[model samples]
Target: MTEIKQPIEMDITEVVKATGLASSAIRYYEKKGLIHSIGRKGLKRVYHRDVLMRLALISLAQQAHFSLDEIAQLSVNQKVPEINRNMVHSKIEEIDTKISELIQLRD
Candidate 1:
């Protein structure tokens, strides 16, 4: 049987183009330990394709108002993050509460 090899690394420009994120945001995510780069490819950071999924998760969490620290707690220098279900539920409840408060204020 023959095995097929897949590309594992992507250039920073590819990532930025795919994710619609700026280079600075990618660098910020790297600095925050949310993602990892295997090496530099001519001044461009190279990352595993897994970074796309990680960045997507980070964006969703941020949209939900999850702090960078909170996201970091879920992921850090790890290929797969350990997500806390309880924490997600708590955040949901918090958002629901805030929405209710806002509705009351508007009425």
Candidate 2:
């Protein structure tokens, strides 16, 4: 007898709640190739659990002003699968400069 693995499934609403992202944003990310759906049950979209982490990373990278293409490149060479340290450091510096400028304006 052969054992069959059941497909993991989650409702689109649950996915959005778990990820703290809007449903439309999820669809946009899927369309942008930043995320994807495993399959659909009726009209509800299902996704693999790993997608949660991927979406979180995408959100953080976007806040850091990293473009989708840059974020994709950062994911390359993924034996360990981490954001590129160099890119992250550069983004931090950019953010710091922006913050400093804002502080000066406020002063």
Best by TM-score: 1
1-107 per-residue lDDT for model 2 (tens digits): 99997446777888888888999988887787777788898998988867777887887888879888887777822334566799888888999999999999999
* Predicted structure 1, TM vs. truth: 0.88
TM-scores of the candidates are: 0.88, 0.71
lDDT, residue 34, candidate 2: 75
Winning candidate number (lDDT): 1
| Candidate 2 positional error at 19, Å | 2.5
Q: Which ranges in model 1 have alpha carbons more than 4 Å from their true place?
A: 1-6
lDDT against the true structure, per candidate, is 0.89, 0.79
Query: Clash pairs of candidate 1?
Result: none
Locate the minimum summed-lDDT window of 10 residues in model 2. Answer: 74-83
Tens-digit per-residue lDDT, 1-107, candidate 1? 99988678999999998899999999998998889899998888999988999999999899999998888877634676778888889999999999999999999
